[model samples]
Target: MKDKQAKWCPELGDFAGPKYRAIVAAMQRDIQSGALPPGTRLPTQRDLAWSLQVNLSTVTEAFREATRLRLITGEVGRGTYVLPGNDAVQLYAIDKGGNHDTIDLSTIVPARAFSSEDLRQSFATLLARDNLSDIMDYPTPDLMQRCRSAIGQFYQPRGFHPRQSDMFPCAGAQAALFAALQWIAKPDLPVLVEELTFPGMKIAARQMGLRLVPVAMDEKGILPADLDRAARASGARTLVISPILQNPTGATMDADRRAAIVALAEKLDLLVIEEDVYGGFTKEPPLSLQLAGRSILVGGLSKLVAPGPRFGFVIPMLEGNEARLPEQNFAIDELVHVTSWMAAPIMLELCCHWIESGEINRHMEWQRQEARTRQSLVRRKLGLPPLGRKPAAPHLWIGAGQDSPFAGLSGDQAAAKARAAGVEIVPASTFCAGRMLSDGIRLCATSPRDRADVTEACKRLRKAWS
Candidate 1:
């Protein structure tokens, strides 16, 4: 006498970790998505296991984990109910005091920069291939070879060339990071990172039981002296670095600094992990840490080609040791097994076609141009000076300088003003590593759908804060 079909049962898509943990995580994702709102009743363990076609013990363990997170309640002689998470609810608030229209700049995503272009030709060409069936299957060694070759070719002109034998396609940047963590970190080991870095890396580090030690940085980027001190002090063998157009703070290291950091890495015997996701957007990309010595360099198409696919690659560098690739391949195999080894065949073919036909280069140019134009618009319309800016970088900052008029305003206060203006800006705390240097906000230079939207948002920003 109940609607079984309508009840919450997780669609556990190719996820890593234990089955029980996956269940808890999936339920949390659903709860945060508002699919299972507060006070909603969940099916009993037996009912859920029967409905989901899983073992009873799995459901019981899942329910126990969910209860531990305070995401659900188990009542005696009654049923389970979703718990309240007001903080989580605030994340997806669309209606701002009764308005549905809002320009979101809080998310770090590439804009649809290229206009007058369509994917019809891409798909048509892909569909016309004779080996279309093989493309959809899990990544075989042959397809991986082609993908790695394509990735290498794309990066060759940019100064960060990678060997195809060492490269393998991953789901995304985070996937590569997870594999790196598993290979380098043990329980309770310390890992060094930029004071302000990608938040996803921080989350992954915590999940892997690695402690993130924040290294100091200067205007040009991570200070070599501080890195040495931290590396020696914490005895951290692994360091995660983003050299070009760093997130939250748009710092780009010069050649001298890159060389210095490399020297320190060799001296300290550090295992370097370079995240060069924004490499193509920069005019003079730095040499990848892989070139220096033993390291891991992550490359992805999501930032350049399009944001739709979870397409990325990880290259394990050991300076042609011949013995290291096998171990690295083993780690990659584990990741692939857990994450479902292949990207969609269509995505793989599209990337290859773009690389072979040289169309991806044109797309990259357009994205860079679009990003610069947006940055200029933000400066002119909002009358805000950009801090830590680089050419064609997709994100920029508006900091409160010591003697500036806006010094009294906190990042949260500034963000609230932008929100009232129907725009959402990321707060400073979102990127804080160990601490914050100043109160500021990061604005996505290429997130809005169009220039007019950003212009209007800037106008509202000026009216509210300036």
Candidate 2:
């Protein structure tokens, strides 16, 4: 059999000696060099061990290492296979990477340490009472009051003087947006937004059958004049904005821009829906554009707090509108409300403790420093120009160069390249409601867990671009 064989597999022979790391390196090289295409079935443990003349235990360990690196996936009653698309695999690995793992610039959360121990203890205390019956009995005025107080305290310094009656609790930001769209805008009406904006809004508008109108913007933000023209042309009655720390772009509206937008909205009699998912991360309180009193501010704990909290509060600028707001406006009714409301008390208590202890502010400051540091690294190491001169909020936007790898490609294509390069980026196309296109990509620096990881990821991105 040995005399008749053509040759031993180079990978098996190259991965010689006792250590399993050689096997991992050999497999990685093969994958990177395209010797093994995606979806290629890997050798079975026993077969690979026999072929390599190694113990089955060595093969098992090697397979585990590959899985850890996200180079291979296994199935029950089936063998492992290479994951489809290098970019997809890279994103999956980066998303699942633990705290001690390398930095991933693709995620959108601050890197500050969060302590949920106190909150967990509070939850346990509440659970000990076992008063589940009362908590489950639908939201009452008392519960509303508690929720309002908790949410109000956070907004008070930000110029949002909200009353208990003005507040409404919902499942999360998406639900609040859905309800707001349904309540405020008529079907088929154009909803104005930044040319580059949040993807969630685009998804929600499409699902609700609302037409989106993208307005032109400058360094400050959406041009007030452009907004006016679009509103007039489309008969748009509502404007959706992220005045502070605008997603994908990370451009905060300066005081002048805010006043100009508010002025335009007042002139047009437009209702504003302010999505404040990144609200809590700002150093100073954001100036609310809810000045028209026709605006609705959507705040949530997902970004500042853990994503699974599933808690959000909506504060309507217009008084007496809550009574007129449709019950369907509270989108949580579709899903079992118990899941969100049951955890409400605990969330409320945590918010209280975080605010009182000043931990929230301290954390925000630390995150700001981290974000600034990462942004600087991206500019210097990635050889990319700054998107703007303002203080970036956890994200940096880079315009693709003419000779850039992402040039001439559509936003999705650029995103694919980024994924393949082992980094995740938000394409600028999703932000544009119309046919407008931008040669920009948004890089998130907040979720990488540490500075070194961010630097390494940036280096990979620079190499990919080159």
Q: Rate the local accuracy (lDDT) of all candidates.
A: 0.70, 0.64
Residue 364 displacement in candidate 1 (angstroms): 0.4
Per residue, candidate 1 scores C-alpha lDDT tens digits across 168-196 of 67777777777666666676577788876
Residue-wise C-alpha lDDT for candidate 2, range 1-466, written one tens digit per residue:
0011112233655556655778888878876776764546677888878887888998899888776565665544445665322232233345454443334565566665665775576466556765545554666656556666767776665666676666777776767776667665555566788877676776676566565676777667788888988778777777888877787776677778888888887788777788888766664454443464667778776666556655676666765444433233344232224223434554554454555556556666666677777788777777666545566577777665575445566455676666676666765544544433344677777777677777888777666655
Q: Residue 315, candidate 2: how far off, in angstroms?
A: 0.9
All candidates: TM-score: 0.74, 0.68
Off by over 4 Å in 1: 1-99, 114-117, 289-291, 320-342, 385-389, 402-405
Top candidate (TM-score): 1
Once fitted onto the true fold, the runs of candidate 2 whose alpha carbons sit more than 4 angstroms away are 1-104, 115-137, 283-290, 320-353, 356-359, 384-389, 402-413
Which pairs clash inside model 1? none
Q: Using lDDT, give the best candidate's number.
A: 1
